[model samples]
Target: TPTQAGHATIFPTGTSPGTSSVVNFAPGQTVANSAILRPGAGGQVTVHLETPMAAGTAHFLIDVSGWISTSGYEPRGARVETIEPVRIYDSDLSGGNLTGARKVSLQIRGAVSTDGGAAVVPPLDDVVGVIVNLTGVNAYGGSRPTHISLVPDDFDPNVPAQQPTTSNLNLVPGQTRANLAIVPVGDDGRIHLFTLQGETRAVVDVTGYLVRREDDTRGGRVIPLITPFRAFDTRLSDFHAQPLGPARAEPWSFEAFVNDVKVDGEPVGKQAGLLGNFTAVDLERPITWYSPVRTHMTIYPHPGGGGEDENCGAPPNISNVNLGEAEAVPNMALLRYGSSGMGPNRLCVFNLAGYVDYLLDVYAVVLTD
Candidate 1:
């Protein structure tokens, strides 16, 4: 079923009710949301949908992209390490379009500069997977919709890798959109991008990487929750039902134990990082606004809690989501905690411009062993 406007939350079965990972959809539109979920003992997860329209007016679908396991004969488990967002590839710099049915390969390991010759944060070796923000620049402007597929870089360009059924980012004509993706890398430390239809430029920004636990002792092992938890929402009555005003930053805190799941024996407040989905909603624009406002939301580790301070200083260059007026968009983020005085399990959200409400649904925690 389709609805005028609706949202759905997914979490582990039998967990007490709370906002988890949320997918918000507009009228007459089919939007897909993704989140990492830990199944119950019976390998089950639950989805809760909320809509203003009648119950029968809404419908939902679920798909499994991949899974993590250690019980199999070949036991494969990996940990994640966050890095400063780095631009690795941009088709525009090469003066070409990522034409349909074509594959472009980009290096992932030990990279120093972008394809445009800009310096970037280099990733470590032995990376099994990478989390990136894939942007599809609408070079060929029109009203048509298209998609980009990310694949393992093990095929030759002449042969052309088979495009997967799933797409990493969906693009609308004349609109540049980005989506976060966790893609596996080839044995040679590279990944491939393929366009499904239409000619468009592509951009790949690396945010984090995954490696086997034994291979690297620097990162944090991922602890998937039996159920995703709603860490914070500025729209809820109890959680302060007010939109974050322009140029404001707010810090929200979380406990180590969520739904009776503990990091270790003691309450370990400090964590290496958190894995979750961040959604920006109800963006407010000026009355005279005509053009699409380019806005962004940044989530970073904050030192303290409560109240806004003009002296809070400028936010880092990293952003979680690019926002537009009256659009609700969600992106997956892997955020690292501050090493020094920053409080434990605390993160701050900063809005670049305009008032906006945001939601955070955490699916996993990163623990340094």
Candidate 2:
């Protein structure tokens, strides 16, 4: 039992003096979030725990879904390329609701853009995986819980793919919720989605994709950590025990080292981007007449110099997390770090409205080396 809010951070073992990944848990709430991470040369990682209350006031559990690696036959390595998020599938616009155990296939290769003429993604042969935001709307499971599952279309290409025991987004009745998922792309360049225990309208927006690197100098390769690591929690005293006020932006530097030693060969200061899970917790409701207050947060590369003017301008229309009052919403983010001269290796988080505390758990780092 937690007396107060707490958090945990996981990172490559020996990497100290850095706060890149983090997850927060509040009293009476058990939250589970996941991220990809790159391990140290020793093939191990470290977990750090903290709380505003007593030490050991919080408990944690870790799980590994799977892993990825490259074979010698491949030319160059696999790298991540992010783009403006674009909607690829929406049940409401296409046909109808997705019922229990029914799967829908969406083309990842050469599909028509859905975000009013956003650029299309590369062909299937160039892509190995895709990062998408999955949302569930108006879900009803009657007496059972409802969940959504996503997988490559080739899981069983000949017929409707079976619903896996796992789930990406779990929804409540009459409520809309969203989650992030990274699914592999099959040779057919399509993916399949299904609902379990109820029917719901589904929406998928692609944020980025993993592709075979055409050149080593362009994109960054993803390095999965041994496990998800919590690197920052606003509730912790050492991390500033305060909630982010409405319409405020904060800059965070990206620093990672192994064994308290900085290696020249590692991507340390050369990080191209990071793949982290961002959560909004303890949301302060607005004083409006709206039944459920809604807000959003956006993250972008920090323009360097660190002056007073180093704040996010209008905040792009894109959002990393769409949050509701009193709801702890978590979303995966694939954010590029600032390049040379422009706040190198840093990012800025901007809160659109309402006050909220943040938790960041890192699962992977994209290296440009």
Candidate 3:
């Protein structure tokens, strides 16, 4: 401790991401400082004052990195944690008895990251509304906040300050819960949704809350909804290449399967895999079959794209292939096809291998379109 070393207050509520604000101490004191870090909190950030010690004025700047966790008491570097911008008053530091502890909040302007590109500032004037709530009252004191305000990011003390406007925001206070809602304006002049919950303030509470609510297992089985869309463009024109000898090519066929299905039955569909320039209608007519030859068939790891995987399967050449006349054009939207049966369809398998689980990541039928 220096000759004039005094007590310092630590903000349990760290700043938000994409913004920067400063914290100051005795104006001219060269205080030797070390900040404790708590993971997920603003990671061990401290500003060393360089000037001579001022009797009772000192401050430091804080930057809100958007990726920071919005939890209560989120340990920053070692033992540090950040407070929510709106919940700072409820923070433990807010009630501490430090003699000269005071912080000034400010909105960041063009706040840029070292590695990230140029920063994009949110529209402050376009903020039209806000609402908030809290839950899990437990044994804590009764909730108290009735209203809230958001100061301008460019507010200056040197100039006369204007009244900070308030929006028609709702503050629902419940015996066991609290809630907030804000209609933040976007660059496109549209209102976006913003909400905050008190349960997500700290790590332990959040883990317990999520496990009790989302991970509850009481029913026999549950299945999430699947989007009715194709993952990749497996149409003819998409795979069409240079012309081949006219030997009356044969049509290609594909089969798909699903296992360990419980509730929503497996996916069903007649998906048109890979085809040269021929459409589904062309399969109506057939011609002489030519001798099958081995060719390179690259199966992408993902529907849209992916890197090559050597362990997937050996490139197998499909023979006795057939070609038909061009029918209907392929739809860019329905790049791949799926149907009830005998197609890009869904299949179900009730019993699965014990202690074994398999997830179908990607399955492609490559053809020379």
Best by the lDDT measure: 1
> TM-score of the candidate numbered 3?
0.17
Among these predictions, the greatest TM-score belongs to 1
Candidate 2: regions farther than 4 A off: 1-32, 38-77, 111-113, 138-144, 154-161, 214-218, 224-242, 245-269, 287-294, 301-319, 322-327, 338-346
Better of 1 and 3 by TM-score: 1
lDDT of each: 0.68, 0.66, 0.22
Off by over 4 Å in 3: 1-104, 111-142, 151-165, 172-369
Ten residues in a row with the worst lDDT in model 3? 202-211
- TM-scores for all predictions: 0.79, 0.69, 0.17
Pairs in clash, predicted candidate 1 = 1-59
State the lDDT of candidate 1 residue by residue for 243-355, as single tens digits. Answer: 98878887665544432446455443335777888888888864445555657887776544335332334565556677688888887787765422443555678898878
Expressed as tens digits, the lDDT of each residue in 1-369 for candidate 3 is 123323342322343221111111222332211122223245443333222453443443232311222233322211111111121122223232111111223222222222335532223332222211111121223333222223223233224243223321112232112212222222333321111222111000000000011222221111211211122222335334212222222111234222221234544232223211111112221233643221111111111112332122221111111112321111100012223223332211111111111111121221111
